[model samples]
Target: MTLEADLRGASAATVRGAIERGDPLPGTAGFAGLVDGALVRDVLGRELVYVDREAAGEGASAGARAEANGSASVWSFDPGGLADPELLPAGSVRPLRGDPAGEDRGEPGGRQVWTLPDPAPETDEGAAVAAVRAAVRESVDEVGSTGLAVAFSGGVDSTAV
Candidate 1:
């Protein structure tokens, strides 16, 4: 049975709510119905989109489903360590720490942002520092940058970076 057949008569909100409630629907093996469609399991034993019901019904198809998920994909990863390296290509970048809203700081320019791997280690302070240092070194080496500027907003991560 295909995902569409399983969700053909279901509403997006209903499917999403089932996933949120951890209630797996039929014809879904290690998969869950998201707001869009069924999330199929990937080679890395991760669940990706088997079929994007929203896009298909809307007559849209161009980019991969991964891009459509965006930040929502973060939920696919286990809440402990980094995601499998293969899932995240080499050179993929993301925040070293903290949320994207930059709510941890008050002043606008006071927040610090460091681009690291998408799924960073939960408590690996040493790894975080090393990633930042490597990024700085790479920038200086490749671009011959004479000076560097880091935004410090009194946050522990910002200060460390």
Candidate 2:
């Protein structure tokens, strides 16, 4: 079977099993399959990790690594009644929900905390297109380089952007 067919045939359970058994899958680029309308990967190639609904809260190791490296930051739109920002130290966990009224806001302590409005829905195709164009322009401006590199995965979202 083709790679796409193999990916389509693989289930989350099967991928998780492979991870547990420390077995390597053939594809270098990860696969994205729709699970309840959310694009999810059975394996994350760089980290060789598997994530699904059941494994959502399984980022403790990544979090720990970030903390160890002092590169941890939390980006959220709403502080969620967090009056004392000091309560959240660097590498602390924060939940994301709701929308911000206006521009993004940030607070820094042990970890960097950024609160920005939730992204507009994908239904707003024009807005999405404009945002991506603006981002590309800004990125190119900052880089001040002739060529632009896009870490593309031949996925719909990256391709569209």
TM-scores of the candidates in the order shown: 0.18, 0.21
**Candidate 1: pairs in clash:** none
Best by lDDT: 1
For residues 1-161, what per-residue lDDT tens digits would candidate 1 score against the true structure?
22342222345455445434534342223332222322222112224223322333343321223333242222222322212212321111111112332223333212111122256454888978998899988875796436866678887777546
Misplaced by over 4 Å in model 1 are 1-118, 145-161
Task: Write one digit per residue (lDDT tens) for candidate 2, span 1-20.
Answer: 11232233356555435444
For model 1, what is the C-alpha lDDT against the true structure? 0.33
lDDT of 2 at 123: 80
Every candidate's lDDT: 0.33, 0.32
Show the lowest summed lDDT stretch of 10 residues, model 1.
88-97
Give residue 65's error in model 1 in angstroms.
27
User: lDDT (0-100) at residue 133 of candidate 2?
Assistant: 95
